[model samples]
Target: MSRYEVDKALWDVYRDASAAKQYRRDPVGFLAPRDLSDEEREALAARDVRRLVALGSHPFLTYNFALRLAGGFSMPFVQDYVGQLQGLVVGDITT
Candidate 1:
């Protein structure tokens, strides 16, 4: 059941080419966190794949926002989510 919903939401979200539009290269707008269902969280946890692969597929916005967060930006609720998502990919300088 969890996997079903995860697959469904991922497919639904990814199938749209417009998902990229949300990034817009605006660090403020792009790195905001968002609510997620259990499936969504689990899906992200299961893989390091970029959720915004349909977007510009770059990490600059995420990386910059992470630096700001580390420097003590007051993150909105959405930023928390973005942090988690970005953390999945950004932690390994060794890689």
Candidate 2:
């Protein structure tokens, strides 16, 4: 499956409060049941935002997930996402 597909599946889980709770409680446990590749699993486990962005994960969903993972709306999380997005867009433009 494509990275986008993998990200969408993850996003689906995050979008649900119960599931997101479960995931936050034990990310590895939550992902253990899914048929994700090692890279995907690692990225989620590590909360590697850059890798997720590189994988074409939805930006808004990623931002939301980051906010949730951080336990609330946080400036650092927002800045991190904005930086990543700027990099992505700038790279696209330069290329």
Candidate 3:
């Protein structure tokens, strides 16, 4: 099974405003029942966008999630997250 079940779950939450609101209010409780790995759980708890992207989360979904969690978009945050993804991709290509 794909480890991205967590990503899909996050996307589902982001797809619905009510769900996203609930998630934003209590992210740990929201994710507590899901069958996510430690890394996935930690990433969500920490709001670690870069780690999520590096772990193969869909960038669009990740961005949406971040925006919802932050109550708006921040260009600097997106730039940093995308930069991390670029670094990971470049590392993969080189290795």
lDDT of 1 by residue, 1-95 (tens): 23333333334334433433343233233323434444445333333234532122234433442333344355563476465565453332210
Query: Could you give candidate 3's per-residue lDDT for residues 1-95 as a string of tens digits?
Result: 23467677668777888878777788888888888888888887777877776676777777788777666667886676566567565122111
Q: State the TM-score for model 3.
A: 0.72
Per-residue error for 63 in candidate 3, Å, reads: 1.2
**Tens digit of lDDT per residue, candidate 2, span 1-95?**
25554566567665788877888888899888677778877877788777766666666666677777777776787787677667564122111
lDDT per model vs. reference: 0.38, 0.69, 0.71
Supply the global lDDT for candidate 2. Answer: 0.69
Which of 2 and 3 is the better model by lDDT?
Answer: 3
Measured with C-alpha atoms, the lDDT of residue 72 in candidate 1 is 39
TM-score of each: 0.25, 0.72, 0.72
